[model samples]
Target: MTTERKAARLPVFDRAAATPEQEAVLDEILSGPRGNLAGPFLAWIASPELAEHAQRLGAFCRYSTGLPLRLSELAILITAVQWRAQAEWQIHYPIAIDAGVSADVAQALLEGRRPVFVDTDEALIYDFAVELYGAKRVSDMTFAKAEERFGHETTVNLVGLLGYYALVAMTLNVFAMRANEDEPLPFNE
Candidate 1:
């Protein structure tokens, strides 16, 4: 007989089991743009102090940043790809599409191929993010192009968006977070 082993769930703080500080942080997250707590926040709440500040920073990066939703989501998808964080990819892929990223572009990114960008801004975001993640820094030409087209503030926000999502991806990856079973894996590998 073959034996099947169930996947181990990471130790995540539930509202009922939360400390007073953790509950306060959970309440704040529930009331924020996030609406419900899940993913990285589950792991983060274990460290209530860090969770409080991190969630606020995440809310700013995700909601109030200078970059439009499409660009910000694009940067997030790039971060997910870089980290191969399935949970992050699953969460952001639909949001990215809703924000104007094409299905073809998202599919190409999933397959580790160069995406056919439908917009100039999309192309710029992909190039800048891929270069930054792969090279640890973008070349002067790429930086200049991003700054010229998006403005210095938007460019800086894009960087921050990328970094914030990278942190989310790292948390998801470290905790072996899984997406909904109905969702397809973002990458085959």
Candidate 2:
């Protein structure tokens, strides 16, 4: 009996030559996930591909009903950095910037420096991510601050962002998803 183990393939969408359906799904996913998948989101209908989940997550961030968009992105960025998922970090850094995370703050987070724009809300969110990722729960003080600044719905969404990105970071790392060789690291290493 032959027993050779084949290598696992990394999950990714070939953006250059995606099928029409795939392209459509990618577009809808990139657009954010408010659809029922019965329409434009059909491309991912019932699909369990990693890209699908990633798209759903992207949509969640884009369409989140609670947290401010930039804050949510910061939470995801923190998870990406802590998990050391280079691809995730690189891909989302621009999104974070677009969503209003300052370039310097994003760079510092990516580069392991203390955040340069530590306002009350930013620090609260950062601490929330750190405690949640580190302990799987929030301390009472962190929870209190989060509620004070963002209320309950945003707090719940923050937790959702953490869980989503944790899965993404682990998947990308295990698959050894490297950043495009041409793309520079999002921050100085």
Candidate 3:
């Protein structure tokens, strides 16, 4: 008996075949902090209008939001795990660590275990994100603590960051995006 294995594929659009609107959106993304079109952008470009709006919103959530990089990346990591988004996890894991999330925490998360956080803010963000992901809403205590630690604007941004990364994770999953061959799944499943 013979068995067949499917080859990995990524459904990327060719800029050479792009419509004017698609070209414009691609240009905007390439010119932004992203400095390149990759990952979810490749899939999103299929609908230029959606791409434009989503990329802008993503830029705000990733770059302009009041949440620090570590916190935002923490939220993104949680979203990635919730969605089992290999692409998102591959891209953000190192950034999360560089932004000050501990390696132990990241590893524990990847192992599908609760991370031991040494920082109060890290603990708060982890609890808030996990509760939100698991319950679709945080408990009043978690919400109150997040609001107190992060303040109103930052708290709102944290929610937005979670939501934005969730969208990214969904896009990557729907498109069957794959991480590089060398990069293993960040979570144990």
Candidate 4:
């Protein structure tokens, strides 16, 4: 049986007829490290002010975070799984692989299985994200482990990164944003 896809709740930002504020915001994002306005930005552009702040926070979380790319991307994937956010998973899966997370790990996550993390740091990050999402707070012991392994600054940055990606996931889900028609959906749900 074929299923009809619902239309996106918001208008995808059109740069041609954009307002001055939209143009400026789009320009800022386009020139940033993330050259393309993919994922959340497609909906965020409608609210230029929110887009600016969210994109800035996202840039810092994605690029300037103290955690290594592998761990940061892992945290992002964890958030994607938690929220069932296909856009987040699709965009980050390749980056995560290149950053050292194995296909096994990504596959397990997408399958809702417990991924056997060979990297101790990946395991620690997975635990941290699980607690943060499941319990709404990390245990003191988990926090201590993260702080010990990553130091206070990096640990704090890891927490910030998870929160930022959760925001991204929510935005994509809210707008029903997704990958191209030809791209397979990451989650079966």
TM-score of 2: 0.71
Instruction: Write candidate 3's Cα lDDT for 1-189 as tens digits.
Output: 111111234444666778999989988998999886656877787799999999999999999888888988888887888889888988888889999888898878877888887888888988998898898889999999989887989898888888989999988887767555466666554
Which clashing pairs does model 4 show?
none
TM-score of each model, paired residue for residue: 0.91, 0.71, 0.91, 0.94
> Lowest-lDDT window of 10 residues in candidate 2?
37-46
In order, the Cα lDDT scores of the candidates are 0.83, 0.66, 0.82, 0.87
Give per-residue CA lDDT, model 4, range 3-98, as digits (tens). 134334865445676888988888899899998777888778778999999999999999888888988899999999999998899889999999
Model 2 misplacement above 4 A:
1-8, 11-54, 185-189
lDDT per residue, candidate 1, 2-78, as tens digits?
11111254563456666899888888998988897656877787689999999998999998778889888888888
RMSD of each: 4.7, 7.5, 5.1, 4.2
Model 3, clash count?
0
Strongest candidate by lDDT:
4
The residue-by-residue lDDT of candidate 2 on 1-189, one tens digit each, is: 121111144333345656665666666654654432211122232243655666766567546747777887788789888887776787678778899899888878877776966567777888888888789889998899888888888777777778877876776566555445467655333
Ranking by lDDT: 4, 1, 3, 2
Lowest summed lDDT over 10 consecutive residues: which window, candidate 4? Answer: 1-10
lDDT of 3 at 57: 97
Better of 1 and 3 by TM-score: 1
